[model samples]
Target: MTGLHERHLAVSPDWLALYYRHPLELTHGEGRHVWDADGNRYLDFFGGILTTMTAHALPEVTKAVSEQAGRIIHSSTLYLNRPMVELAERVAALSGIPDARVFFTTSGTEANDTALLLATAHRGSNQILAMRNSYHGRSFSAVSITGNRSWSTTSLSPLQTLYVHGGVRTRGPYAELSDERFIKACVADLEDLLGHTRGVAALIAEPVQGVGGFTAPPDGLYAAFREVLDRHGILWISDEVQTGWGRTGDHFWGWQAHASSGPPDILTFAKGIGNGMSIGGVVARADVMNCLDANSISTFGGSPVTMAAGLANLSYLLEHDLQGNARRVGGLLIERLRAVGAGSPAVREVRGRGLMIGIELVRPGTDEADPDRAAAVLEAARAGGLLIGKGGGHNTSVLRIAPPLSLTVAEAEEGAEILGQALHTAT
Candidate 1:
């Protein structure tokens, strides 16, 4: 192993997984490509788990961070922070919550934790409803609401979490049902589950299940659930950590796909807003936000440097219309990938909207997941100068492709070609 790899193994937790048989140490990046410490360049399809929203080494974001660092790195939440306020304003305006209030955090875990806090306090209940095969974050509270067995490490939790169905449309019992019937069944399941509970604070879900291998329900599944949650006075919390800020391409926010019910009562976002900086936040109705009787603050949540990066990143994303690029290029990439998958017996599905895509791997002519093959494909892809990621519900059997929103058509096609070779070689 390399010296850095040996050192990482010594210092990192056993559960902190790394990609490839020999993990790579990326030294620097530009545009859609990154270079390893050994001077090999690769197309970064996973975007560091979708955190690099715009592109690698974006000049606008770098300049903002540098300028802000020169002035002030952080003043805590005690002092007036202009950049924090400005970024919050932009986020609030876009959050779609009426009379919205925004609270910043340092990571997606903290953001979800704050959302759960707000939700339970507002409703005076510690009961939460979550979708099966869903992943929110990695905090104690966040994990409590998580339904993915692979990610939910412990059974003990602070809240009473009820796992509902309908996150994955392709593997569950409802897979054979039509889209309309699937929505109806999930809604019925939700209503039935609620009949056995009381004082549910909120229903937290990802419009697109990220760690669950990019799986999603029918477009209106959440909209259908919204009607039931409203009757029970339960808040709907949309965890947009992976699907937020135009990453999904077709919509600025993934929740917009279920626009029939309007916005959620609360929305939590992270990963991409600040490009690579640490920035996560919760947006809620003013009344729900103020429901907390005690004052709370995040020390490193809205640091000036991070907020400046977020503002610059957001400006660049909007001005350049990266979302449009994601739609156009991602469409072609998915089509190309689907064509490639058509000939592979191990390939089960190529699914997603916009830039977020997943390719499931299974044993040839069988329904069983092939996590071993998935890992091999990951290694092969890296060997071919492409960096992708993997995730699934019960096992790591799906290849995830979520490049930066600014990916060009040429880059997409090149990456697809490399990936096709990887899939075949690994098989």
Candidate 2:
């Protein structure tokens, strides 16, 4: 192992995983590419797990952070902060929730924690409904609602969380059903689940399950669930940490795909709003937000530097119409990857929307997941000067591809070619 790797292993927690067998230290990044400490450049397909929304080293966000830091990095939440208020106003306006109130946090975990606090307090219930194979975050409360066994570290939790169906479209009891029927079955299952329970605080779900290997149900499944939830007066919390801010392409927010049910009662977002800056927040209806009895404040949330980065990053994203770019480029990339997967026996599925795509690997002619083959492909891709990510509810057998929203068509094609070669050689 490299000296740096040895040192990292010595200092970092064993549970904290690294990518390649011989981890490459990335020295710097520009646009869609990054260079290793060896000065070898590789195309970045994962975008730091979808946190680099616009691009690497985006000038606008860097300048904003630099300028803001020159003035004031933070002043705590006790005083009136202009950048925080400005960012909150922008987010609240963009969030479809009527009379929305935005509360900033440092990470998606904290954001979801706040959401749970709001829902439980507002409804006077500690019960929450989460989707199977769903991953929200890593905190105690976040893990409580996370249904992914690989991610949940402990069984002990503060809230009663019940796992539900339909987060994953395939490998489930309803996978064989048609989209319409799938929605119907999921709704029926939800209704049945709720019939046996009472005083549920909320139903939290990701429109596209990110760490669950980008699996998702039919577009309107959540809308159908909304009908059942409304009957119980259960608030819906959309965990948009991975699917928010136009990452899904067709819609500004993933929840919009289920617009027939109107906006979610609460929406939490992180990853990508500030590009690489640490920024997370929850947007809820005014009543739900104000429902908290005691005053709550985030000391480092919405700090001047991060808020400035968020504002500039958001502005650049909107101005450049990166959403449209993601749609066009992502469409080309998925089709190219589907073509690549067509001849590979190891590939069981290639599915996603926008820049968020996943290629599920399986044993040849078998339904069983091939996590070993997936890891091999990841290493081979890196050796071939392409970087990608892997995730799955079933042993991390899925190749996750979430490039920057500003990816060019040429970059997508290049990435596909490299990925094809990696799959061919490795699997």
- Cα lDDT for residue 369, candidate 1: 96
lDDT of 1 at 134: 88
TM per model? Answer: 0.99, 0.99
TM-score of 1: 0.99
Clashing pairs in 1: none
lDDT of 1 by residue, 1-427 (tens): 9999999999999999888878899999999999999999999999999999999999999999999999989799999999999999999999888999999999999999999999999999999999999888888888888899899988999999999989999988899999999999999999999999989999999999999999999999999999999999999999999999998889999999999999999999999998999999999999999999988777899999999999999999999998898899999999999999998999999999899999999999999999999999999999999999999995989999999999998999999999999999988
Off by over 4 Å in 1: none
- Which lDDT values do the candidates have, in the order given? 0.94, 0.94
| Alpha-carbon RMSD, candidate 2 | 0.7
